[model samples]
Target: MDFLLLDDRTNLKLSIIRKLEQQYSFSERKDVLCEELNISQYLLERSVTEINEDLKQFELIDDMELVEQSSEIILFQDAQVSSSVVEEKYLKDSLEFTLLQTIFFNQFTSIKKYGEKHGMSRTVVYKIVDRIRKELAQYEIKLSKNFQLVGNEWKIRQYFNMLYYRIYKDSDELYNQSDILAVQELFSEIKLYCEEVNTLYLFKHYLLITLERVKRKQHYFLPNSFKSVEFDQKNKIYQTVAQWSERTLKGTNREIEVEIRGIINQLSVYRLEFCDLENDVVTEYTERLKQQFQMNMQLSEIGPEFCTSVKMTIYQHQFITPLIDLTLRAIDLEFFHERYPIIFEMCHTFIYQLKEDEFKFSKKSLFFNLLLVLSQQYDEETDKNTINIYVNFTQGEKYNRFIKNQIQIFDSFSIHFQPVIRPDTDLIVSDYLPQVTFSARNLIWLAPPRASDWRNFGNEIVRINRELQLNKKRK
Candidate 1:
């Protein structure tokens, strides 16, 4: 996934940026980064010089320099840019990227002609295409001799969805202006028929991909095993999609039906489905996942909604797997994640137990998305340690209430804002210098708090929670 979006040089650049990000105080000796990356100090110095230039060129520096340097030390300024933003910039500038975009949108298929258009030799164009071919082949997709993307139409569309997403992002750039307008109307029409079009930006992109693929006479193909699962032809969502297909897409009746089913399958699995509610395979696997997640600390509560969401995720994954897929994903093991370690490990164990040899990205998606949903439904261990806070300001009760309103996180079970000060108060937050002077050990604030004050307030909460844990252990 990383390789697809960034070249080695950009990856190396990002690695440096990430390392610098880990240390909030940005100054690191050039020798330190050089040793960490196992490169020469001179090389590291040169890279730093280039990095400053690259950051400016990326146009995402956002009026703040992301990297700075002295002779011996590289200094970093937090540009507050996300990894995705940086990645899109790098991806857009790649030679292969431009070539592929031209092929997809501009029909620049002839290698020699492409070189002439782009001022590169045919050999260089061939090499770039070869690399793309190899990468796509890894996902069971083929860049054909005529440069057509050949594969299962569903998977191919998914691949193009990612490519277009990474490059254009939320921009209106998938097709020409007229076609973009047409697709927007098509999306609006579908939105009228279905309320699940929650994100217009993403659905617009998806509709464009579908239109482009259908224009190329590419339609959906399902695996034989899945073909056995029966669909309700009269299902409202299915009927709506079929009707839309008739009006919008160019295909035979069967092809349009298959494509419509494929589109429904691409939608959220929680919706009214064509085949999954009673499927034994989906139900059995859902139960198996629940059983596999048995752990020391249970979710404080598990409602019907949580169970249904888990079931539907499994159902969706069951039908969505291909020999390989090209969804843009980067999944990290969440065993040590602070907030949801229990849920993370439980999800990991359940996913590991599944005997099927699935693709890395698919397993990653299941684990990542399931953990996200589980964390939302469950409370953290930290939430159980209550921190009773007394808010006192030189200002009156109304002003104190305003402060509380500013910082209050309603969902946190760990922190409670007490109405009055008590001896049992775990912490004190006050704007009066005299009030917090004696109890500086707990926490303090100013009338107009700075960002660092809020940060310190959070740190105090963590410290109080840790103290409670230690006291429980002593008992």
Candidate 2:
């Protein structure tokens, strides 16, 4: 079913609705739903309201209400309509969503084919195609006359994967139980190399997708280098995937290799250095980085765990696809240059020496990782008075000067403003909150720091500083 028409919030609402159906009529604790769904109470409350508004359109129910009491939320479903009817109505409303998925997967290659499959008239198909075209345009993708999608292949795949996850929420429903079991078995054999559940799911999803695409006679060309040499030849994880493909797929070795590479590219499977690459190579690169940066610390200084992490990062750059966007990374590089110019210069020099084109895609991530390693060594000796603040502003030079002044005035706070929000930030002093979720308890929302705003801003800063002190004391 084409559930992409329903955004994540709406999908979450429907999930809640379906859960309510199972209960028939009962008071379910909000915490239970929140824990199951991994959503905040604020988000659950908001989704409930939006879902009821949508339900009202079908005249299926008066409204689904969650009556809040002490430590519990009571859910009341409309008895007038059965849960199955509500589900069917939603499925019927989601045909356009399904159509988009069909187009993306190259399942239906023409308006006539789509119309035939869905029992829709030519006129209706044309309208849906037009809407799809407009939507693709927003992503700078093109919908051609024959229903083929024309765009950067990675971006096309990205959009498809995003929509797929938004609709299904997970990969469990995308494949049959047998196929899932097969993939799980393969994952188990190599679980020590990568044990993350999300990573396993992603690998399985792309593997299934790649198999389907290959069976449909859709093939990707392997570059001469990847085909000529067996990359990560000694890696057990690579060996496992390659062996599975040989036994399961009906293709030549070269074609199977291409499919395996395609899955790797789609999943961005880095952090495989545990099984790939030699220790000497990683040590050489690590030493070069330290020398270029003129840092006194050695690889051993950061200890074994962090040393492995840096090596994995270096290995990851080798398989990265070029088309993926690094705009945020570019912003991070700029911010690091402004805040810690010397360290950023060292990173730039080290990356330049590496001379790998793929480094362009991940130099920021590398720099950040290197920075963390350095911080581990240096932070122990440094005082803990400095608070890291992330400033989000775009007034150009004015914002720059304002940040400089703030850093000087609030010397105890290490102010680092960027075009993007960073996770390591102690406080967010932004002109406007970006449409992203953050968990900072000390977010100071204010206009650009003018002379008049400083008093109130300073008060907020003091409160946060005190809170931090209290937290430290409790710890």
Please give, for residues 306-365, the per-residue lDDT of candidate 1 as tens digits.
455666666666565332123442334523254445566667787788766543446666
lDDT of 2 by residue, 116-208 (tens): 888999998887777667666655678777777776544455455444433344546655466667667767766766667346444455555
lDDT at 144, model 2: 76
Q: What lDDT does model 2 reach?
A: 0.56
Give me the runs in candidate 2 sitting further than 4 Å from their true place: 1-51, 55-96, 104-124, 131-159, 166-169, 176-181, 192-199, 223-230, 264-270, 274-383, 386-459, 462-475
Error of 1 at 284 (Å): 4.2
Which residues of candidate 1, in runs, are more than 4 Å off?
Answer: 26-29, 61-64, 71-80, 193-200, 227-237, 269-277, 303-306, 321-336, 354-356, 379-385, 388-413, 416-475
Task: Kindly report which residue pairs in candidate 2 clash with one another.
Answer: 2-98
Local accuracy by lDDT, each model: 0.64, 0.56
Clashes of each: 0, 1
What lDDT is reached at residue 78 by model 2?
A: 59
